[model samples]
Target: MIKATHRPKHSSIPLLALLLCGLGILALGTGAVRMSPAEVVQALLGPHDETQARILYELRLPRILVGALCGALFAASGAILQGVVRNPLASPDIVGVAAGAGLAAVVNLMLLPNTPAWLLPVGASAGALAAFGLVYVLARQSGEVLPIRLALIGVAVEASLDGLRRLILVRADDSIAQALIFLSGTVYGADWERLFRVLPFAAVLIPITLLLHRRLDVLSFGDETAKSLGMRLEPARLVALALAAGLAAVAVMGVGILGFVGLIAPHAARLLVGPRFGLLLPASMLLGALLVVAADALGRGLIPPIEIPAGLLTTLVGAPYFLYLMRKTGRVR
Candidate 1:
């Protein structure tokens, strides 16, 4: 028993890292042209064929990097939200968070075609913050946060928001092609500029998340227990929720709403490494990155000169897992 338990704990982090590295290499090498791994490595190291070099530098590298970053952020945000809400179903995608971002993004794209590119992310961030505050307010009762009530409220809000989004999409005069793709979430057109835009936020937020890991662990242990342990319940919850919303918003802006990675990765990591927040967070981030990179690579390679959306693949993969988790919990109600 001890060996079995110890083995996973020891192997989880390294295994996740190795998987991420392998996926990164595969994503770089396997596309329409199909460069060998050696060529991919050479291109990354320096210059190879100028044409291939441009493809790698300008196109594939950024998509892979942004996919990895967005995956990590989403997964980390899910883990944090799950811990705080004490509900496995409490992912940003499941709740109203992604819908909030999507609503703003879609509205902006439809109404303000000429809006500065940079402002898209800003709008997304604002929408996310607003949604987070709305959920928290609805979830609070007499200075106490109730997990089940919060989750139910979130589900209702999400359904309503999703309905609104669909209605907007249906009535709009513009072509729905771009709106559909963005709703499905793909990293296809990501470039170095987009990567650079989100990097600073990811760099800043990930470290803060790491630092707050301990506090999150405490928060997971019920409100009364956390209070007994000297945690400022409301303030800590607000801060964590805000950070998570910002992370989720930035990711959606960067790569559209790639769902499932956030919900699936953290749960898988928890199963592998146990529920210790410290190990869980980093392991989930790496595994999440790996999943998106692999999915993106598969999307490109699955069809010749045609690709599926990475978000669609993630949803296909995630839905079964979500169902299984619900069953494990013995009904979502």
Candidate 2:
């Protein structure tokens, strides 16, 4: 069980938020063309230089917003999945959401390149929902989706989807760059439209996830305890999973396969703020925002004009943490 920390638990919220704010400033000021703090501040207020203003307003600001929004959404989704499954290892990636989105996104990019740009998100969202529905159904036994069953079935489904993705990649010779962009995950070309694409889901779903903190808290006590406490386990689980999938889907739609933020951010928050869902959710969001924005900054500045995909950096970092978590949770068991 996750107990409250020795230090003040709530302090993490502000600390994370402050850190995120600082990173946002850093992201705004440092890129291909460096700007001083004062210059960035001035640009925000309105700048006479068209070049500076365009770089700040048209290039930097939108990517930062989309990165932050997608990061927060991914964290909220991860937190919800972890709570609902009563598994510290659970995340949107673990439960087939990212796999679904990735597969659908690849198909859209490769097969339907001529379709409207907006259809990518729509197709990806539908694919995510379909994968979840399959997992939910296949995992059900006598109307109950056991956590173990759900996890196992989800992994199988995800592996199968991944196989399909690889098959598609090998057989195709066209739209490889476009396909790779969604698969690799990036905020590189993010602009006002991308920001707008991801904003609504973050605004709506994050609040709903917050409102369900009591349920998440209750669910964390395990299945029998939730049932004994008069909670409808199946209904609540479905709802939480739906929200989690939706949050993850939009993120995949907006950027690409950013699988690790959902996994990493929640545990980081829980370690600092404890497992209380109310605090954990918001803290995860802030940390996730900070994480992606920082990753984007790192990618941009790491190689100068050459940028790394945000997903690659996150997976590089989150993969080790995931192994550590598996071992830690195993030892506890």
Give the Cα lDDT of each candidate: 0.81, 0.83
Q: What TM-score, to 2 decimals, does candidate 2 have? A: 0.94
- Per-residue lDDT of candidate 1, residues 1-333 (tens digit): 123453448677888898888779888887787888888899878657888888888889999999999999989988888888887767875447777876776687787876676677667666766776777788889986677777888887777777888888887756534544654678888898889889999999999999998899888888988889899898898778777777787788788788788899888888888766889899989988988998899999889479888998999999999999989887646
Which candidate number has the best lDDT?
Answer: 2
Q: Where is the poorest 10-residue window by lDDT in model 1?
A: 1-10
Per-candidate TM-score against the hidden true structure: 0.92, 0.94
The list of candidate 1 runs beyond 4 A from truth reads: 1-11, 176-180, 331-333
Clashes of each: 0, 0
**What TM-score does structure 1 among the candidates reach?**
0.92
lDDT tens digits by residue: candidate 2, 130-177 = 788888889889989888889999999999998998898888766655
Model 1 per-residue lDDT at 276: 67
